[model samples]
Target: MNASLLLLIVALLSGLAFWAGRSRSLVVAGVGGVRTLNSLPFYYGSLTAFWCALPSLVVIFLWSIFDGVFIEKLVHPLIAPAVLEAAHGNMDLVMNQVRNLAASHVSAASVDPSVVAAAERLNSLENINRWAQAGVALSFAVIGAIWIWLRINPQLKARAKVEDIFRWLLFSCALLAILTTIGILLSVLFESLRFFQRVPVTEFLFGLEWSPQTAIRADQQGSSGSFGAVPLFAGTLLIAGIALLVAVPTGLMVAIYLTEYASPRMRSLIKPVLEVLAGIPTVVYGFFAALTVAPLIRDLGLSLGLDQWLAISSESALAAGLVMGVMIIPFVSSLSDDVINAVPQSLRDGALGLGSTHSEVVKLVVIPAALPGIVGSILLAAARAIGETMIVVMAAGLAANLTANPFDSVTTVTVQIVTLLVGDQEFESAKTLAAFALGLVLFMVTLGLNYFALYIVRKYREQYE
Candidate 1:
């Protein structure tokens, strides 16, 4: 049987187990009163279903993982030595040709007779494997259902057992997340260490120049590349600063208006409209930045005759930062509004009783009460701006210029990482390893921001609480 059909059969069997278990419990209760049962009928049903399905699912998962390896091993001996030698010991390529021949994806005239025989063997093994998997899985599932069903009684603590299983499932999910994070960190750290062995960490951190083009062959011109990363760091900060300048005040003011002054009807209409900005893809925002915002900024600069003192490129950090700010406005506004609303109304009332005006109450009481959450929201928006790649790539030219001016073209660390790893590049090269090093730095910077945000939150939260 196919995997999907097997899954359907398992589902049907589990459902049958649930029905049988529940009906049995109800019948037993009808004879001996409901109070005799240790758990609810629903729990008993769920416990039986779990027992029936869990073992079979494990079998299916384990079989699916190993089936391809077993089939490949079973067919490898059928390929003639000459055909295997021509494949250069690449078992994956040999298997690919075998599959293509078996499926008639490759013409018979294009491949060797030995390959054709190997393909036939592979097909036969696959068929046998599928049948064996289905048979074993179904038999185990049926046996599990019968054994568990026989154990079900009026005194069975089905609810306790089921809840314990769910608790472990939740713990496993949390453990998976932690392990995934650790894996990412370790991978980046090892790659960055490799990069640093070739390029000095001090130069990467403090050097002003930002060239990373190390040629693969010595004959290539410009092969002796600089590894300084200060320009990229400066560009990232310049754009992110502009983004925070645009986003923080605007988003906070909008949140204030919605929470403090706007009517219920106006809030209902305007909030959703504002939040719609967040749903637009970052690529779309990038297009708007490149096509519209960048050109507009350049034209505005020329019209104002500021081109003499301030040179604005068609692609500038200002445009990308502005578009990114617009994209994150809803994130800030929505979070801030929720936080502001969570402030106790009694604080406002108490401030008002002291002869304070609406503005005074908001400034002294409401804002203080909501300060920690507002700080968190702003930090979240700032992180979004820093991590953005599409807008920077589209609106800002990839010329890692070390300048404070927003009108100057610049690139971010993420854009440079992508540029370094864009093609079929060898991972062993310093160029590719540089991407991981850049990622490590970005990760550390963001982690520091989160820690600082937490510190600020805890410091102020104690006062308000």
Candidate 2:
């Protein structure tokens, strides 16, 4: 049986076991009195389901892992020598042809009788394997159910055993996440080292020009792509700085107003409306930036009669930054609002009791008390702004201009990373490896921001508490 079918059968059996176990527990309790039972009826049901499924599931899992290899081994020797010679003695190639023929997905233009015979043998073996696995899995399930039913007495510690299994399952999930993160870092690190070998680490880090067009042919000029990443870094910071300039004050003020000054009805109505901005996709924000905000900014800049020097492109950093700032406002506002509200009422009362006004209570007591969380919220929004690609792509043109002017077009690291790895390209080339190097730098920047936010929070948290 296929995995899905097997799982469905096991699930149905487990469900049946649950009901049976619960009913059995009730019957036993009626005879011996409920006080004699060690655990509840629900615990008995859960434990029965666990017993019915766990061992069988493990066996099925192990069988599935080895089934492919076992089937290949069984079919390998059965293949005619002519078919093996046709595959140039390559087991993998022969196996691929065999599998394709078995699945009736042959890609070759010509057919061979030897391959056809081997495919028939392979199909027969697979059918037998499936039946064997199904039989063994069902037998394990039935045996486990019978064993657990016989053991389901008043003295059974069903709840504790079930809880122990759950505890291990949760730990395994956490371990999987940690392992995945480590794998990503190692992959990026190794690829980045390869990139650094081709292009000097100093040049990648500090060089100002940002062209990464490596030619495939040796005869092509500029094939040795300059991997200067300073422009990307500068563009990222410039746009992010502008976004923070707009977002932090506005979002913090919105949070302060909603939490401190606004009436309950106004807070209820306004907060949700503000947070709706977060649910809107970044692409929609990009459209709004490109069609509305960018054009408006350009016209405004031109209308000021300072056209001699004041130039604002339609896809300028200012447009992307402003829209991105608006997009990230919900992040800062939502987090800061929660943090501000978490400040104790006692602190506010104490501040006011010292002849301080309501404004003084908010500014001195509430804000300072919640400063760490507010900083954390701002940093989180800054990170969001840094990582945003669609907005920068649509609003800020992908020109890696290393300039400080917000009115100029610029690109970001994420935009270039997408550009580098979008199509089929040779992975060994410096052009492709450059993406990993960019990713590593981006990861480090984000990690540093998180660490800095933690340090600030820890340093100031106790002082206010």
Candidate 3:
């Protein structure tokens, strides 16, 4: 019996015990003729149910985490020295392998009989777990029934007690989610700190280049792992710039059309169609950029008599950025449409009544009112453009040449991270660790943008609301 099944079994039994206790108490209190409760039998049932379920659920929760460690300790001491050494130091891996071997139907090459025996032992442990589950679930039900019976009285405050427990449970669940996010950020920060210790923090932050390739042995000691990150940062900024240039104005216009002018039927039709752009997998956009968009741009440039050496390739930053903009179009359009529509209709009407044209009212009153939300949406889209992986990976080149030309190819940080961690690279090396460092920087950048957006929204809200 796993923990979830045990929790559910306890909850069901608790509900039943609650019903029994409430029915008996109602009969004793003269609220019913040897029958139901006055405050609704279901409410009483629920109250008793919560009590029976809550305490045992807490116990099951605590037991789940500590039980495995305790069981492993006992099992290890019982094993022979040869078996223990053969299992290797990875207890979890050995346990998983044993379980798989026990369950598997196929016999492969290099199969050992000792492993087979260990697998058999695992089967025995499985049976033991089933028995323990049944025993514990029964114990919980019996104890809960007895406790509810003792607690029931004619004037008992069962409803309030149930509510208190439920409120605390919900609060604890919310806190758990927030704590998990903090835990993840802290872990990333610590790894980045380690990376910075080996390579100087100032060099990483302020250096003008980024190429993480270093020597392995003394024979090849002098290698350039130039931590200067200016070019990569500039490449990211340039790609994101091109993406926004395409995405913002087009998305805003679409939003205005949808919100201010479209009929109800047209809106229902158009909103879903716009969202379909969002739903298209990003990898598809990458393929389109590499195959279709890049060639079109290159041909257009040739027609204008541009240098062939400087023309866009299939993997140019412009191709990737344009595709990425198309991918995030729904984000800008949908968010802007909602915010525009949310502005009171009376405001638009007032402007029209004061001898203003429809376009004039939209440009002067509606847009100013909705500007904060629009800015927030644009910021989010820019951040998305910066962090995107698949579109850039399939379309942008791996070279980080610092140039302002939209036709030239450039690499993004995400593409670098993927290449660094690909195949069988050593994890302890600086090249791999640099990915974590880059992640930490990316986190900080996005966080700053989000906070700035919030500040603008708050200031605007203060003036308007």
Candidate 4:
């Protein structure tokens, strides 16, 4: 049977087991009623259902993991030794051909007779494996159901056992998340170490140039590639700084107005409309930046005669930063508004009772109370702006120039990472390995930002609390 069908059968059997366990508990109570039982009928039913499902699922999972390996080992002997020799030790290639031929109804005449025989044998083994897996899983499910059903009694302590099992499941999930994060960090760190071996750490960190085009052949000119990352870092900072300048004040003001001044109806209308920006896809924002905002900025610079004084490219940091700021405004305003609203009404009233104006009360009482969450929101928005890829790729041209001028085109670390890993690339090359180094640096920078934000939060949170 197929996995889906097997799962459906198992679910149905578990449901039946739940009913049987509940009935069995009631019978054992014997006219003293459910109050005589050590646990409730619900707990007895749940315990039976858990037993019926868990063991069967585990069996299916293990079978799926190892069945293919077993079958491949069995099929290996069917292929002729001559054919195996001709495969040049590429067992995976020979196996892929066997699987493809097995999947088709008519075997190709051009294929060797021994390979055809192996394909037929593979097909028979797969069918047998499926039947064996289904039999084992179903048998385990039945045995577990019968065992739990017979054991259900007044003194079983079913509730405690069920709760313990659930607690262990939650712990397993938490451990899985931690292990996954550690795995990612170790993978990136190892690859970055390999990259640093090829290019010095000092040059990667401190060098000013950012070209990463390594030549494939020794005789190629102008493609030896410079790996200085300072230009990319500078561009990233410049654009993110511009975005923060646009988003922070505007978002905070919008939040303050909605919470402290706007009518309920107006607040209801405006908040949802503002938050809709967050739902729009980033690629849509990219299109707006490239097609509309970039041109408008270029034309305005030309009309004002500013292009002569400054380098104004069609794709500039200002356009990307502005659009990104708009995109993240909802994140800031929504979070800040929630935080500001969480300030105690008693605090606001006490400030007003002391003869402070509404604005003074808000500034001294409400903002200080919400300062930690506000800082957290701004930090989140800054991270969002820094990590944005599509808008930067579309609006900010990939010129890796180390300049503070917003009108000049520039590139970011994310864009460079995308550029480096765009196609089929040899992992051993310095150009490809450079992407991992960039990722590790970016991860460190973000970690530092989180640490600083937490420090600010803790310092202010103590006084407010």
lDDT of each structure? 0.90, 0.89, 0.77, 0.92
Q: Give the per-residue lDDT of model 1 (tens digit) for 209-270.
A: 88777777668665656778999999999888888888999999999999999999999999
Clashes of 2: 0
Please give the lDDT score for candidate 4: 0.92
TM-score of every model? Answer: 0.90, 0.87, 0.83, 0.90
Alpha-carbon lDDT of model 1: 0.90
lDDT of 2 at 406: 82
Selected candidate, larger lDDT, 2 vs 4: 4
**CA shift of 92, model 4, Å:** 5.1
* lDDT (Cα, tens digit) per residue for candidate 4, span 1-465: 899999999999999989998889999988899999999998898889889988999999999999999999999988888788899977887888899899995565867788899999999999999889999999999999999999999989989988997998899899989999899889999999999999999999999999898876568564767999999999999999988998999999999999999999999999999999999999999999999999999999999999788999999999999999999999899999999999988899999999999999988889989999899999999999989999999999899999888988999999999999986556688999999999999999999999999999888882544
What 10-residue stretch in candidate 4 is worst by lDDT?
Answer: 215-224
Name the weakest run of 10 consecutive residues (lDDT summed) in model 3. 31-40
Any runs in candidate 4 off by more than 4 Å, and if so which?
A: 66-126, 216-222, 462-465
Ranking by lDDT: 4, 1, 2, 3
Clashes of each: 0, 0, 1, 0
Q: Report the C-alpha lDDT of model 3 over 1-465, residue by residue, as the tens digit.
A: 766677677867886787787675675567444333344545566666766676666666665666566555545444455655677765666666655776885352345556566666666765676567557656766777677677666566666766787799899999999999899899879888888888998898888778888665458666658876667777888889899988999899999999999998998998999899998988899889988987787777778777556755556788888999888888899899988988888889999999999999999989989988898789979988998988877777788767777777888777777887885546777777888888888889889988988888877662444
